[model samples]
Target: MSLAVALEVTPLPLRHPLPTPPPHHVGQPPTAFHNPWPSFHQHSWLDALLTSRRNRDFKPVPPRDQLVKIVRPEWGNGQDGLKATWIGHASFLIETPKQNNNEGGGRGVRILFDPVFSDRTSPVSWAGPKRYTPTPCTLAEVPEVDVVVISHDHYDHMDAETLQPLYERRKGKINFLVPLGNAVRLHGMGIAMEDVTQLDWWEGVQVTVPTAGSVKLTCTPSQHFSGRALWDRMSTLWSSWVLECVNTSTTATAPGPASPLRLFFSGDTGYRYVPSEATEDTVPVCPAFGEIGEEYRPFDLSLLPIGLYSPRHFMSPVHCTPEDAVCLHRDLRSKRSIGMHYGTVRGGISQYFEDVTEPPRRFREACETAGMVWGKELALLNVAETVVVRLDLPRLADLDLEHVRSSKHTKYFGIILDLFDASLKKTLERLRLNTNSFSATLCPSLSLLAQMRKSSAK
Candidate 1:
């Protein structure tokens, strides 16, 4: 089927019960959105500004080398694994695994999320929060993007400077997925309305890519408000997103099991509200995340915000502290998550209180506290650094030992055996499984198994 035709016909099956709708202001535009629960406390912006000048010992902007590690993103034709490249705050280039096409080789569908490549994340170039960290690579260096997924209309998350050039460079071939009431902004950029897909909370759309098959994009709830300027507060909607790769290919050409790859983008969200001097333990937190975890448990990868949160009373309603992020990671039931939205641009008054480098440290400490291994269950990637996850492997428990012993698909057993430790080898020995019976070329190296076991023990 043609890509457009497939998109129109293939609606993703609702896998779980639909979530409750977000509260909206009555008599306002239907797009005027609010969080599911009350998010803010009594703290005001004036209080944040008044306290912004407090002396902080840590540098807001770290040395460039230590802050961003530049590397050319290696996006191998997405035939095997899922890949994500961190392009600084709240921006990522994600490629879903691709199935083989009529052509012998092909690339995966590339989705760029909230790409802000400008020197400053402001409505006006002369002012607002300027980026202290440079982009790992220039926009020109970014590879071909198939779809652009925007989380909101915030200047930091959405930039006209980046989108306009990106539209022209790609010659309007890209599809844009945005929250409600935000399409007008893309329309203003001269993009055809047909190319933009605007979704409200709990809405989903399937996009078909010639190389990647079908991918489902869902507009999920986030506890955040949105506006670009003073008067437009709550005028538009804000959202998080869920992307899942749907297997539509009749031919099983991909390397991994047929299990779909799912990802979550926590655009910009807060877990709960914390009043000044009050502990977060008893406060009413946003319940959307737990609902999200219920609907989409075990996300293969999740990109969550972990910075720009300070003066917990004010920022916690919109931004996530590292500790809050850890809770969010657990709430979403993410298998692996990477932290973003810090170490890029230092925002205005509210952002001054937190050290730029503090987020990652706190994130690491929080992960450790949660018993989640850093770089395995959760991670903080360097700007421009690319992380790849092997989506083909099934969980260790999913493999049947009898099948491994009797079936011709011993190649999968070899790969699975390489992922565990001595215990797994001992299990194989107890079963009287002979290594000589398996294909030597198909088995992964023993070093990987040892490394995995070592990492697991920690």
Candidate 2:
């Protein structure tokens, strides 16, 4: 059998495993789940370096001996609510809600998102971007997880070392959901494929929790390409995950559904389709802008990329600019967003710019210019910080929306046709959505994203 099919076919043991009640949701994990497949194909390290333009200046700072005493997770506060702890980058340990202590579970559910516990994000453990911060939650301190979700196969997004240890520690107690092609990588890494669940984009996996209800984790689309090496760029898929919790009965139409708690984990993207930029003329399939095939609504909370986009010439297509991040925050319709992938790791050599430093300051100015509102006071996080999302809280809409760039022409109108064509034709496509829609003379040069951010971080 081909790798995709073999990897996708879960063994009967996993196809229908013991239905233990997941601890957190609004009520499910938060588990020792691991992706068990690995790819045997060898990626060329030489090509990987040449194509990558990562910043290598920032090195890993030694961990704080802050004395973390390992202990079992403590069930917190209450249900009809939620909490998420950002462990840096797209990594977050979400606190799942438990109906009550009556269930035979522990301190709620602690689910880790994109937990890359590896020292570096490269094929080799030592060669990639050195982390700026030590992982905040240690393996011992981490709460028992019930489900693990792998959005894609990119190194920074998915790591072997980390998941391996997790699988060994948790065993059958954990389960995993990964993208279609990622199982190959997990299998090569020696992880058993039986317990792994692979889903295509827009597909979902239902976790049946007893009192806590169920959460249908949906894998959604993000505007980014995927590949760990040149030969396989876009070979596998990249996506953002939408984790929604349902408190109502599994069959109930409307069980007074509390705000469906959701968190969007943006794998890696360059903010392409903003409802604001999409127009009838530009979008082929659904020319009427906001009506794109499936215009996914804004997530309740979001973790967005805000860095690695200096020297616009090359980075524009792959990484998002600070301003673009602002625009994405708007496009995704997220209530509160935490900036990530900026300060966590910086190992790409192309990242060497004369003026910029780590934690690129331009994003702050961009948010300010866009009048972005986040956190308790509604301000962008200057560094690694945490914020709680409240559906019924006061927001910072005090920006001069009239003067924001969205109020002006961003030149995205030009690509509406191309994006539409790609969507309509249903053939696979890749386009670098730069600020400049591309002049007829320069359209050929468009694919050479080496010319991305020469101008600004903002």
Q: Give the top-scoring candidate (TM-score).
A: 1
Weakest lDDT window of 10 consecutive positions for candidate 1: 409-418
- Which residue runs of candidate 2 sit more than 4 Å off their true CA positions? 1-80, 100-102, 105-109, 209-213, 249-255, 272-298, 354-360, 374-386, 390-458
Alpha-carbon shift of residue 87 in model 2 (angstroms): 1.2
Which consecutive 10 residues in model 2 have the weakest lDDT in total? 411-420
Error of 1 at 222 (Å): 0.7
Clashes of each: 0, 44
- Best model per lDDT: 1
